[model samples]
Target: MVREPSDRSSGPEEQEGVGEQDGFQRLWTPHRMAYIKGENKPSGPGRDDGCPFCEIPKGTDEDGLVIRRGTAVFAVLNLYPYNSGHLMVCPYRHVADYAELDDAEALELARFTQRALAALRKASGAHGFNVGMNLGTVAGAGIAAHLHQHVVPRWGGDTNFMPVIGRTKVLPQLLRDTRALLAESWPED
Candidate 1:
């Protein structure tokens, strides 16, 4: 295996690049982009988007595995889930931050979250979950353009050698099967 860089190579390699350091020199690297915005840029907009969360429908489809859809919110199966029944909730509007969500949109989001949790519980016997959002790029938002909440189901003893030793998460059920179960048991609000 290749070894990590030593102190000597790091210094000379940096200088040889014509001293061409960028403002976000330490922020992003080709190997791994730090999700966070750097000092040169503003922190976050926390605002709506022209091509943000609202664009989920353009790619998401029920037959392809969407679970539920509401007036202002929707839920879908996560292809890459932490467990068998991981899901995601997004608002029809593609805005970041809790502040921009109005009364109706906020209520819909909350209601849909509840529905997703209930369905996951019924489908996979999941009594607990880890639901959250990574607001900015630095916060681990893979798609920073659109903000959404992740509802990860958990069971006792679910953390096993697969994730730790193998560095892989294994789902017991297929994405389609999980989708069908959740779709059938979706709680109507």
Candidate 2:
């Protein structure tokens, strides 16, 4: 569960932009501005016309990018990732809707999805994972097509003033290394 910040005041004015940033200069970072704008806009990857996540990149490097690939399923790094270990397992057949998943494929996906969690945890020693799929385009889904699932690693105290105040995150690991760790540790089925 997302524990609300304890010291925060419970008043609209108090949260006009979110609590005191001792250094007003920290908010100048572009990432924070975009984050603030995103909060107001409430849009994500799907808004991009050249949606990379929708179509499987044919010639682009998938070795470090694509963490794993099965017959009908494949896992890739989320280009605009939530965290270092963020990944998405997508179906080969291009279909926007989630209800299109067949029983067998869906079942395998469930099993593999569990594997994704296990592998990420094994690789990163992540405290936990946030696994989910955004159903419709309106639901913050980036690709909208090719049903996929997200696996985001969560560590204690991932949230800090950096984002709220400084607009940054101190990611402890590189995405490439994370890919290698998860790919290597993932169980073969």
Candidate 3:
């Protein structure tokens, strides 16, 4: 004799604790709303339209997520980081192209990038780093109008199926917390 499937087994919702349990856990990150909403995006390349890089320096270091400040450049935590200690080294000038940087800015940019990596290593035990610049909008720069070099700290097994499958990056630490740690470990002078 043939039997029909039970009505209660129609879908996962009907099963006991089955709908909520797929053997995978989730980490809700509602704080990313500002980035998603483009809250601090520059209206134009000019500093007048409220460029984040320019405005950041005006605020307190902790409020700005700044880890270190140099003469011509500064290191700040990436608002939407690729990893826990992701940093962006940016020149104070609001120039879009790397070639536009003055010699002082250029030198400080490199110096800040190195310093950022060192601080990340000491503070977070980073095993590797991805440090580079995304030159333009077409090159994957989120803020193309302002030049910034990304220094993303990486560790073994840091990459997982989450980003590929869910289109989400899970950062274990908060930006402020990471900033404080890096700031504490920042190189003197």
* Most accurate candidate by TM-score: 3
- The regions of model 2 sitting more than 4 angstroms off are 1-64
- Ranking 1 against 3 by lDDT, winner: 3
Worst 10 residues of 2 by lDDT: 20-29
- The better-scoring model by lDDT among 1 and 2 is 1
RMSD in Å for all candidates: 9.7, 9.1, 5.3
Cα lDDT of all candidates, in order? Answer: 0.69, 0.68, 0.85
Clashes of each: 3, 1, 0
Off by over 4 Å in 3: 1-26
Candidate 1 lDDT, 40-85, residue by residue in tens: 1223453332343444466656554678888877787765577887
Error of 1 at 59 (Å): 5.9
TM-score each candidate. 0.69, 0.69, 0.83
The alpha-carbon root-mean-square deviation between model 3 and the true structure, to one decimal in Å, is 5.3
The collision pairs in model 1 are: 35-137, 35-138, 36-138
> Candidate 2 residues 23-140, lDDT tens each?
2232223545544454323234342333344444453434337777776777777655777789888776665677888776787678778888888888878898899999877997
- Model 2 residue 106 CA deviation (Å) reads 0.9
